[model samples]
Target: MNHLLIATLLVCLSTTIRAATATPPPVPDVEIVLRETQPLTFPRGSRLPLYLWTPNFPTADDAELERVLKALEARGIALFARWGGNDFAKASAFPLRVARLQKKLGLETSVDATGLAHGFYNGTPATGHVDKDGKRFFDKSFFWSPGCPFAVQPRYDAMRARLEPWLEKYQDEQLRLDFWAADWEFDGPNEWNSGWASARQCVTCRAQIPNLDTDFAAFQTAVRKVRAEMQREVFVKPIQRRFPNARIGNYAMNPHDGRRYWWDFFEKRTDGLPAKAEHGALYRPWAREFEDCGYTVAMPVIYTWFNLHGEYPFANHQYRWFYNLLLEASSTGRHTTPAVPRVTFVHWTTTNPPKELPKDFEALTETSYEELLWHLLLRGHDTFAMWCPAPELAQEVRPVHRVYAAALEYKEFLDHGQPVLFDVPKQPGFVVSALQLGKKLLIRRTDFGPAPAFFELKLANGTTLRVPKVDGKCLLLTTP
Candidate 1:
């Protein structure tokens, strides 16, 4: 009897070990329709910049749509469309038009879907209670409002129902979720101080925190926890399960004021409740979470174009901020997943300067456009997507076209080469990147300052090469 019992225990232990060591099932095979497209190649380790054009699909007529599509394709640009708005059902038909146009033009017609983070309301009765002011809270702007309580089961179920059908229809394409959380900071206007603040007083939300009504800390903690939970469980996990093979990209906002509310809540750490953490410390973990969960791309859309003029004219201080954040995040040994490349989406136009530019600064010049792109490329960003480019603004479009031509001129070197290698003891006002293609070595240096500057490059063989100032900020050199 004793021998039999020992043998049974050993057998059970062997079975448990096998289960633990077994590999997970492979992710479903997803059909990539536009794998050959230029913009689609960036996610697959290509160094080329992915350019996307954002245009309203439902309202665009067939002729106008074709014109825009052809124009963008001529420049190797891809279309990024929003999937879940009030007119989403109607917008579903837009993809068919895009596909047909691509076929007609002999172009790859795959449109990437943009899932607006807070735009998932199905127009049904609430399974949750009303806010303190007896108002229904829904997202009014791109950012999250405290009034919108998305923690209720009914809301999650409704959102899943609405999203699943759309995902099923386009299971083969990539989906990018934008503005994934609230943007609350001291710098911005305090819009949440009114009824929006009391909107979190829903029954389900209140049940999560005992002292939510009286304790401000408790209310903040509860709201953060609910938002993170909804983001992960409702927004992220279900989509992953439904479309196991689709490429999921998240546009996580790197909150400007250094408050990592989502990261703190997700980790259940309340010690630094009200204090601001370093930007890298906050965004790195948030990005890692999505990366580990099979997200192909994660980009922090820095929403501070208005504040750019306050610091330096057309300087793109935000790009430098994001670059430093990426440097800090990578230095820590915690991010074990695949390295996610950086992308910048800048709001640059002539007619509408968000705020007044400095006295000596011009609005939008060819130099400003060129400098921004060069800085992003030198600082380690893989792609740059402009928010909106109005063709009507001929002055602005002309400069943009010039820069686009320059990018295309260097596509062969930029697309096929390895990551940019920077020089040690980096120059103060200049940034340099070197790439070797076969026997030829190409070095590109960009000057960030207003004044033209000269530089020198010393090779390992103790040979020094002098670089001259060009007409523009960027200069590309090839060695024999």
Candidate 2:
């Protein structure tokens, strides 16, 4: 029979784990062994920062839905959110449904207020971007007509109108509205899905903008200013007026890293001279403009876009590169908005995927997927707002649940402890990161390559503890 695991795990670590020759006085040698690792239990007061939000998290009827919800809840998901459920047209239903979810599951809901703001996905003719001919910009693509709307005064008024009902319904405050974010699609001044330069052709552009044809930098700045102001006035401000405690932000609201990455879209200009995506590379970040948006929470969309491999000719990228990208994101958020908490948006699956993986192609393995999850928390982002697929919820997310459950086990260190090692040397065919809490240190070392015989970890107090390898899971250990 499997035995009950206890807090007195040090005894097992001390005895079973093979140790190097000498032991220093203050710090003792130890390594924990996961005997009967199955049926991972949630810590008594689990304050794990892992959140799971499905498409329709709260569907009133089905027994199967409840089963999936309970299973997800059991997986030590500390927070729940509605990624998509309520109608954008009538956002009044949003607050009530979330309230119902909170009452039934006994977990708070992180609101995705995309619809709360008045902007459309692909804005309409009356509201969307209009050229001198009064036609929308980027109005038609091969698959869809992605209309980019300019942030003008009329839309702002409509935003307030749409918000009144949501505001009135949300006054009840039935659920704890802790974290809030908006996945406002086709937002911002861009050359992609929407158009920024197309505004040059706009009649309003001719009137509002000075030297519209020549001064592209001014044009970029102007459009960004209008968009940010709209976001602040329409989405963030109203929510703050009602729910002061809400940690509000918009998705991809982190520090802009310069011009967009290379792709098929408008690579017309090769010279790095102007602040345009067309310029190849020259647009400086609009630091003041980002701050003006008034985001209480810095929500960075840190998805596995490259899992080190996004292109057709697949390449095996190093683990350090991927890990450092996550670190950069977390650090960027902190520097940009030091006062605000970082609630990173994560997707377990690669957002940009190849149509099919060749037999020889090496993408992220299952173990690597788990490691990515750990690194997100290890880098000290407050929590994750995860998006899960609708079908086969339990099985698809079971591995993630394990990672979450494991995280809660050391909630104290994870919450309070600072990361001593961010750039863990990728030597043992695996990657590692360490968190320190006073004398004791907790390490999360996950294997990506072939299983090594053993590896050594040096502590804060100058002690080296050699740890044996574990299979099929993350190797978590604490030094004594």
Candidate 2 RMSD computed on C-alpha atoms after optimal superposition onto the true structure: 14.7
In model 1, which residue pairs have backbone atoms overlapping below 3 Å?
none
- Give the poorly placed runs of model 2, Cα more than 4 Å off: 1-49, 61-74, 78-106, 115-151, 173-175, 191-194, 206-219, 255-290, 306-339, 352-354, 358-360, 392-395, 420-432, 445-480
lDDT of candidate 1 at residue 286, scale 0 to 100: 23
Model 1 gets an lDDT of 0.43
lDDT of each: 0.43, 0.54
Report backbone clashes per prediction.
Answer: 0, 0
Candidate 2 to truth, TM: 0.67
TM-scores of the candidates in the order shown: 0.56, 0.67
135, model 1: CA deviation in Å? 12
Output the number of the lDDT-best candidate: 2
Candidate 2 lDDT by residue in tens digits, 248-282: 77766665444332222222333332443311122
Per-residue lDDT for 269-352 in model 1, tens only? 233223434332222122123333344444444222332333332344433322332333222212222254444444455323
Clashes of 1: 0
